[model samples]
Target: MLLNNLNNDQGFRNFYMNKRGPIINHLCFDDDVILFSSGNRKSLKRIMRTLKTYEDVSGQLVNKHKSSVILHDKACARRIDRAKRITTMKQECFPINYLGCPLYLGRKRISTFSVTVQKILNKIRGWFFKFLSVGGKSVLIKHVLQAMPSHLLAVMQPPKTVFEIIENAFNRFLWSGSDGNKKLHWSSWDNLSYPINDGGANFRKLADISKAFTTKHWWKLRTKRYLWSLFLNTKYCSRIHPVTNKWRNGQSHNWKAMCSIKVLVENNLGWIIEKGEVAFWYDNWTDLGPLYKFLDPDSKPSKLRITDAYQNGHWNWPACGYVVSDFIKAHIERMQVVLSDKPDLPIWKITSSGKFNIESAWNFLRNSRHESNIVNALCHKAVPFKMSFMAWRVFHRKIPSNDIIISWFKLLASPNCTCCRVSQPENIDHIFFQSYVASSA
Candidate 1:
């Protein structure tokens, strides 16, 4: 309300967002506020007056010590000193930590996101990973370590180096159970991160997890009704809807992260047609996707609503501008459009309820990557996981057996059955069957 009055008074002007982009005056979340404005003495003094008025009315004082002024490097000396005197706050640099996440301009550096990697390590501090069994360690990594980067990854596209450093920590903890000690990782992460059915250890990769969830943020832009979403739509996605938006230069990193999985979002999205509120030409209301694709470049209908052709529980065939082929008719016939007072909703086709979920997104992204019936056989519920863990290793030939070691290290000594001291290739078959101890048993 105060901002509305200020705009009306014409006392302050917001900073330009991008090249011909929306003017974002401020972004407020919880108790924190991020104000954006053109650097000028008049606007700076106006902001100070507004803050003073807010403190007077609300009885909540603004902390000058906690706040700092930041200006563009090109901001003139007079404007900087005037801004400092008016705002009564010291000037700070880029990459200020606010609300526990770093906010900065331009490209991210190693030190920029290094704080996130340290946060993951902090979660595992004081733990004796060396003593934990394989099963116990797996549980901790999945539940604790893996969850550490989720919030940051959701907010921004994380650096590939950040993912690598964190994954290396997971590998170090899983194999040696200690950061200092060296141990052989019998299987590569690609093999180990696959589901149990695929003969893997069922560890999820952080990169895949991040990619699957990038679409979730885009899903919220259209589906969620919130103040931030309103501003986001006004500021960034006004001219183009998120699903169909092609890339453009000078876009924000947050928007770039959401666009990373544009294909997945477009393909998996389904529309719940109610009152024909969805766009007929652009929305994916049919299995063949948007109806616009079927028409010629010059002939596609403009401003045509689905309700224009829908009547009396059937499609009015002549209402369409283009020829409706038998193939197109078949797809349209299968669509169930319900007329109700409820507003139209976009559905995430990956889930049954038409709602987006992280687990379902992950499952959809990771689906068919691995399929093995051995999941039921190798992992048992009632027994100790130590035994199950060993059985899992043995089944995948991941144990440090002489045969496996010989393949990896190529020891100078010829392979022998270490258990029976037999002069033969120390292979899984010979050690388990042909040895005297196994033959007599």
Candidate 2:
């Protein structure tokens, strides 16, 4: 019926889409209907008349007062007043929240979402994290504090200042002594963001969290076929299909963030070579990295799919224009290939489950580099969270011994081991091994 009206009514002008023919200027999801028309009195009246006619026939009333007009560009006051008179609706204010997204024209500022910042601070101020054990604090930080700003992060990436404020609150809560006194920081923020077994407390990093959410959006764009994706396809990616086209800068902040994360996803994603969607030379199909990297830098590149390197469902090494190394040959031999009618698919290599998730993304970011094998030894089923945290402190040599405390605050003139009444400084090695009490115990 909407399409019929667009075809028949001369007053109705379809929205001009760049990639395709004009489309109907309306969006209806469930019970909500948002109608779009040109910024003119005639078009507004036509839409109002159409809505009234539909309502009269369907036994429903048009709520004119509840409706609003939101203009992105600056318009003359008289023009806006005329639009208001035509539609009998008020103009919405800028920076209004629509469907949980802040809509405004111009560069994003931290103060654009001041309400979110206050909420985080209020939640932190109410908590008494000092009374809790290290493990307890860890659990609360993961389950409560980290999860607090999740809705905001999903739609809009918060500024660095916002992230820092939240992280500072977490840091103060993590290291508060009795009666709200400050305690010495045992480890750096970067080390604490690692997994528990990696000699630091496992805390959520906002930067990584932001990247993960944006990456999930990219995953949805690739896997889900919907009206929104179709609109994106028509507007930004009409010339080339997403699989083959390089990412471009997006006009919107959300799209730009997704493009940045898409680069990160490219490195961790592997192809499940079915029907040769996987590029032979560029994609990570074989156990080895992209085959193009092995070729001489002077060699010209070509668009080669994985199927090109197969003949009669067997390996065809000569198809590649490079001299195949023995190592590459062995790696190819181990890769099982079964050609079928299915198209190729992508798998997240960081996860054993072959799916994209927040946990897998966090683990990838946390342990991808500088991983310590001591994680295996430090993490045991029998150890409690507090004990494990203490052991981690010991491993990092971060215990607040007398010598370190004195140096950190200049509390004492001497660096003597108080427990043993010795003149030597009290360090990790001395407190744990050299002291008379420690040796006796």
Candidate 3:
């Protein structure tokens, strides 16, 4: 309603988008208002007046101090000063932190994402992570440490170095502890990244989480009528199909990040082939996977459709030039295609219901290669965290027994069993099983 009044005002003008696009003067969510302007002094005054009027009508105060008027870098000094005076808000530059996310132009830099790293550090600096056991650290990593940077990861693809820094912090906190003392890590971070059911500490990689977020955004863009989706579609792919559109080199950081996960999306995105609009080689309508994958990686893909391969209601692979093995060919040959009036729609292949969900997307994108293991039982609520850590240490042969310490430290000491009269090496096996005292106990 405020925007409508602003548009009607003779002094107001919108930011120049493409010639054929939505008339987006400004957009707001909650108290966050992202205003677009043509940088006219009269226009800025009009916008403030409109805001003031809206506040009067809706009983919502428009705090000028909380708002900002950001102008293009090339704008003249006079325009900048005029904007500052008109809005009475802070004058800031690009690469600024807006609502906890960086709004930057061109390539995103490390400095642009420094706030997230700082936030993560601030969240953990007060806690004594070194005093915590493996179980305690595991819980903190999942529920606290990892969750800190998730908001930033979902929106921005920070540099590889940033991810490494955050990961290094996680490694130090979990293995070496917060005291900064070096310690032997009993398990590799990769192993620790798996879920408790899969015998890991559940310290997931933020990189994977970022990919899941990108995939979620892609799914929304393709399937939903969201505001951001509409804006992005208008700006980048107004005419072309969202899935098939080839990304130009000049695009934003998030767009490139979204493009980087195309293969992951294709693997799980199925088609509801109705009008047969899905590409024959590019799409996965046949359920055997993208036919393009079966072809040579360097082969120039020929443009075709699902309807092209069918003649008189029968599947023919050779007719489509998709030279797959007889097994794959036979699989597609037996499959039936039912043509309908509706267009092809994308579906999440992970579930039968055809709805895209974050959990399914995360599981698929994370590429869980885990199997059931002892960690499941060890992670029970009744078991103590330290005891669980001890059991894991014993299982991995990392316990500081006499034989282990002597052999591991490259120093010779008494190798005989200390628990019994039986003169046997005090190894993990003997200490736990072979010794008479151990067996009797």
Candidate 4:
């Protein structure tokens, strides 16, 4: 009903996309109602009148005192005052939290997203991790600490320092004892973040997770026609191509940060050009990258689409005069080009399923190029968590081992091997194997 009245009002104008399609001015999900309009006296009056009408017809009164007006444009101070006077509601400032997310007119600041960090810290500080076993603590780290930032990361990209802070807190929680005394970290965070199959603790890396999520969001923007996607496309990415466009620093920090993962996405993003509509020079349809890059410099760039290689939904070999090399010929022949009537499908290359999901993205980001089997015993499922952790320490040469405890961390007083009652240096080798008592055992 409010929409109807607002639509009829000649003076009212809602935000439009590309100056072509009309965007809805009001959005109501459950009890949360958000009304948006141009910052003008006429538009504001129309909105207020529509709300008043809705109240009268529905027998529900809007609490004007609770509802505050926020103006995006500071230049419209007079108009803002008029709206405030007409509605008898207070005018709120920008950078205020709306439904747990910070809303502001300009670039995002680290300070704006500090709430998420504080929330995570508060949760960690209150937890009784002392009673939990290593396995239980690992579960908490994965499900609780890692999950805390997901909701925020889904919508916006926090600063790099934010992730560093988060990871530091995680490190303390994992390594510190129940009494809060610091213990030696078994492995570097990078090594511990690898997959279980690859001999890691399977812990997620903060920076990588953030990048994967942001990249996944970018994928959605390309494939999905959401209102936010449409708005962003019409506003920011209208002139820029997805693969080649560089994110400018002056743009919205949220978008700039999101687009920062474009290179990673491009490296892994593949397409099934069923209709052959892909751009021959730019699109990643072939495994060898853009065909233009492989071509001789003397060869003039052709305006040929991939469709030119086909005639009546069948591969036309004679028409592909551009294919000069025997390798190109074999590559094309090997390609199962069943030209379907359906549009092309974009896929994530790292995943076996070929769909872009957060889990797959995270896995791609955390995957190590070098595979090692030496740590497999340490990460084996049969091993207890504390033993596995200890094994990790031994693998990384981080065990306290008397001398290290005495010298490096300065927690212990003596360097003698206590188990063997010998003056020999109590290094890892001596404590575990070389000592008299250890050898006897």
Query: In model 4, which regions exceed 4 Å deviation?
Result: 1-9, 20-24, 27-30, 52-66, 105-107, 128-133, 181-191, 197-199, 275-280, 291-341, 367-372, 406-414, 421-423, 436-441
Per-residue lDDT tens digits for candidate 2, residues 164-235, read 878887887777764566777777666788655554566768878877777777777755567666776677
Candidates 2 and 3 compared by TM-score, better number: 3
Count of backbone collisions within predicted model 2: 0
Best by lDDT: 3
Name every residue pair that clashes in candidate 2: none
Greater lDDT among 2 and 4 belongs to 4
**Judged by TM-score, which candidate is best?**
1
lDDT of each: 0.74, 0.72, 0.75, 0.74
Q: What TM-score does each of the candidates earn?
A: 0.85, 0.73, 0.79, 0.82
What is candidate 1's lDDT per residue for 70-150, written digit by digit as tens? 998778888888888888899987887777677788887767887878887776564654577778888998888888778
Each model's Cα RMSD: 3.5, 5.6, 4.9, 4.3
Which residue pairs show collisions in model 1? none
Clashes of 1: 0
Q: Candidate 1: misplaced stretches above 4 Å? A: 1-5, 16-24, 122-130, 177-179, 235-237, 297-304, 307-340, 380-384, 421-425, 429-441
Rank order (by lDDT, best first): 3, 1, 4, 2
lDDT string for model 3 (256-315, tens) is: 877778777877888877888677876777787777777786764566777887766777
* Counted clashes in each candidate structure: 0, 0, 0, 0
